[model samples]
Target: MSDQQKRLQMALDAAHMSIWDSRIVDGQVIDGTVSWSARGAALLGLEEKALTQAFRDFLACVHADDRARVLDVLQDGVQRHGGYDIQYRVIWPDGSEHWLAARAQVFTGASGQPERTLGIIWDITERTRQEIMIAERKELAEVTLSSIGDAVITTDPHGKTRYLNRMAEQLTGWTSQLAQGLDIWDTMPLADEQTGATLEHVAVKCLHQRQTIGTSAHTNLVTRDGRQVAIEDSAAPIWSRDGEILGAVVVFRDVSHERKLSQQLSWQATHDHLTGLINRRHFEQLVAGALHTAKEQGHVHALLYLDLDQFKIINDTCGHSAGDLLLQLLAKLLQSQMRDSDILARLGGDELGVLLPHCPMEHARQVGEQLRQSIRDFHFAWDSRSYELGVSIGMVEINQDSKSLSELLIAADQACYLAKEQGRNRIHVYQEADVMLAQRRGEMLWIARLKEAFEQQYFRLYAMPIVHLREGLESHDEVLLRIRNSKGDLILPGAFIPAAERYDMMISIDRWVIRAVCAHIQSVRDSLAPVEALVEQRRRAPALYSINLSGMSLADSGLQDYITEQFVQYAIAPEQVCFEITETAVIANLPKAQVFMHHLKALGCRFSLDDFGAGFSSFGYLKALPVDYLKIDGVFVRDIATNAINRAMVKAINEVGHVMGLKTVAEYVEDEATLAIIRELGVDYAQGHAVGNLRPLVAGLD
Candidate 1:
């Protein structure tokens, strides 16, 4: 080569490129010299002095696997009378490998004879290494995606499935091969759990934004078999290196079990766990809504507040478990009697309220009566023992003119008080006057008063003697709750108990009663020795004193504990306590009361079914109460000696009580003739103004 040509070749060699020249004659290499730049020599593993080597020797530098194929290609190129460009791997002399890309051109003589071939070689080692590394990374990513437990799927820009991992196959029951190229929505339907509507909008949004969209809970997707499966999923847009939106990739996991757990929690929040009835909070909300609707639509709605009579006795004697069963059974009964539009809610314990939308006062009356009768006729049995359940219902009709929910509730509560006062197990409608008063107040003045009164000792106790009709002697005295107004006038319990109960103040009042009764008993024991022995002998430590228990108090789970604490603090024996619960309250929250009864009985406390055979007289409930006595309702005794029905009822009750090993007491007994008739009917005790009106604890002694 000339000196200038050699220098040019040396310059190109320093630039890390290669050059070659070859002479071709009839498809045979007449002569050839291949020179490579330093980098190219390093890539091909050839020394600079070996540039004149034979073509066959140069071919040996190519990886053995690629040698034959490369040589054949070169031979074919010569035969075709041209040059070639190709990329191949070369094992260098230093045992290192490189990628080389060679390009060549053929020069022919004017006579058309193939002449010299000149080729350029370049070191492509870095590019080749980078490409291999990219390929390896892609493979690893695919493998990792497939290995995930969550289903993974990728779709093309058109939303056609392009890839699916193993989890996708397992979850959707479709193999990747079958899923690929199919529209994603068609392959797996997505829906909202609550609305049951297709998630077409979300899918469209994902496609438009080229971003991921998914939920981790409360979502549903369809599988191949058309079964809906709840799942949580997320999708993200896939992009190419150039920032082109390729499609979207999504990850999903089945959460059917988690969804079920969430549903269960929701149920617990809104429903009573024991009886599966609407809970107090939920019931209040339902009533509030009903009132709003009724007022807005100018429609009348009835609110019925109910309590089971003598339920505590059933609970105390039969055990709380039995009481619970009875309550559950009663709930079923109440539900059956009401229209589908009616909402029945347990206001905690043995108290339940029903909202009757579109119902007028007349309809409310009919429904309440029917409900009372159903309970009256119902027979509840625990173990081998059978009891009759009775309910007292008070109802108030509300129209657009009604002030508020609180006013409506107060009216209904006042009616309930009237029901209990007139005789339990009956239904009472709110009087117009009472409703007007409540509406005028708009605000609940009673609630505020009760709260203040509870703190200020505005309450007092009165004693009514429970006399033995046969001996004409006082057996024990029943303690009656009375409130004194600011003017010092005595007010009956019926005027205030409903108010206290309506505002959830009954719990406080009950606690006060306990303290008051305890103090009264202590006073009687200190002042009257004969009365103390009489009470002690009757298991009424301070004298078999009777105290009323509200339906709310019966339902309070804390009631038994409160009673226990009172006894512990006051050093009072359970046997000295006689809890007087109306027949309606006992049967209303029979289950909860039953638990309280069992606990109280365990402490030697006794119970009485007060106002028995009042408005609601359930023979089954009577049989159920763990009572030592059944107090005949005052209504039955008002004309007991003259009225045949009253006489017959009194006879039946006395007979039933005797048969059940219980004492029968008649309230409202006023004359000797009535007392004589009661005794003839096997009545055990009598209490009334006729027996001599009840007096203050101190005055009674004088």
Candidate 2:
């Protein structure tokens, strides 16, 4: 080779390039006239001797996918009389593919036609591979952003929108194409969910702060179509590798359904399902607030407690569904007659409460009368039958005199009871002089005190000895319940039993007594001796004890299970205990009482018909009851020695009880004379001060 050719080859080799020379005529390469440097031949995986082939042979080395394009570019360059740069793939002898870039210039003859071409060719496979990888990654990111459920938007550091995904387009109603150059605040308008005021864009904050920014709670998105949607959103700044802020990405999701459901749940919590009125719990909260205002701000308010009269008749005659419908209708009627400021609530079954804020006593009375009149005029129809309904309303003033919410409610309830007692369809205002109302209020107070007694274990058992009049029978004790007041003063059962019975709390009290008595007896028996003594006592006969059960307890379905559980828990034998139920209780619910007595009797426990002959003194009920003893009423026994009629009554009861294969016990044997009379009358037992004064059963056991 010449020195000049060698120098040129050296420079091309240093640049990792190759040189080519070809002869072209009329925009076409001539055959057998193409030549290339050794480096160019080496790029095609061939030796320099391979260049002896024609131009068509060299063209054959180009990849099949790129051969036609390479020919077109060469022809265009020859016709234009200018240089062309082209990139194409080539296949080596081993069938491996590589990218090649070529730059060529066309030389023209005197006739102004292309003659020869000179080009530099180099391999670009690595650069091409890197570019393909980067493009694939970018396409994958786009697809991922478009497919996600949450809306995604990207903005420049200046807070200008750059891209929006498919979800963003759907949520904001602005496509990426249209929002590309707009401000992010305009592209995604936001507002306060509650106030309906426009909110600043979170992306703006993210850009300024260069950190993640979360939207305030309860934010709404104002769409392009002017629709508001509840949304939760967060924006985070995008940072370059060198720690410079490049842009921000905002992610958001629609929460409209969640917000609506939350609101619905809140509504349901405070409303009564049957009447669509505020429930008692929420109403009491409002009344409590009013009471606070009355004390602090001297605001006058009034409360009305209304109970539907003869509602039980409707419920029993037409079924509870009809009663429910009637209540719903009455609620709407009462609401229509009240002012917007007044709140009405369903206190409980067939009962409602109304709060009149900023109203005087006279106005409250007028409102109550109006409500009562409306109820009286209303008629409820069911299944082709119509019935007229009436309301008894009680009004109480709320002022500085109102001490508490509970007291106010109790006062109103008492007044309502007074209204019903006097006559139905009437309005009664609460006053301190209402004796009946006072008694009822006292009973209500007893309910609270009784509940507290149970919680604090204030109730204690006391027993009075029942002396056995017949021979060979051991004396037993009759258990009585007494309560300890807050001041540690003992209260007799007479003070609280009536209240408990009236409020349907007798079953709870009876259960408490049963559990306490069983525990006491088991503890006493256990303490008297160890396992051997207990076994000996069981072998002989366990000491008998009597516990009083109220009328309500007989009707309680769970009471039997409760008593059985207590007996098992304390390990007390059924034969060691006797249950005493009043004659009134047995007669009031004869079937339930019979079932209760029979169940316990079958379990080896004895039953006594207490206060016998006090109610329905006839002997007919004696045949039906499965009782082992009849405790003659204290009234009859208290005067048996002096009163002939009382003596005759006790004689008749004892004789009849004996005839029915039952024993007769006499109560209120306060003197020897009464005791002597009962003994003469063949009474099997006597109980009262004459037998023994009351003493703590627990103390005796201890």
Best by TM-score: 2
List the RMSD of every prediction in angstroms: 19.0, 21.7
> If scored against the real structure, what TM-score would every candidate get?
0.55, 0.60
For candidate 2, the lDDT comes to 0.85
lDDT of 2 by residue, 87-182 (tens): 998898999988989998988788887788888988889999999999999899999999999999999989999999999999999999999989
Error of 2 at 96 (Å): 4.7
Encode model 1's per-residue lDDT on 1-702: one tens digit a residue. 999998987887686676755666565652344544444455566654434555667777889988877766666666677888878888888888878887777777887776667877787889999999999999998899889778888888888888888888878878899998998987767888888888863444577887767655667888898778898888888789999988888788888877877786577578765577888788778778877887777778888999888677686566554666788888998899989989888776688889898888887888888889999999887778788877878887777777787877777777776677677888888886866554445336677667667776677777789877666433478887776667765556655776677667888888888887776666656666886677665752244777789998999988888888888777777777889998788888998888788788878888888878754456877666678888888767756776666687789888988899988889878677888888787788888766656666545322
Inter-residue clash pairs, candidate 2: none
Task: Tell me the RMSD of model 1 versus the true structure.
Answer: 19.0
**Highest lDDT among the candidates is held by which one?**
2
lDDT of 1 at 379: 88
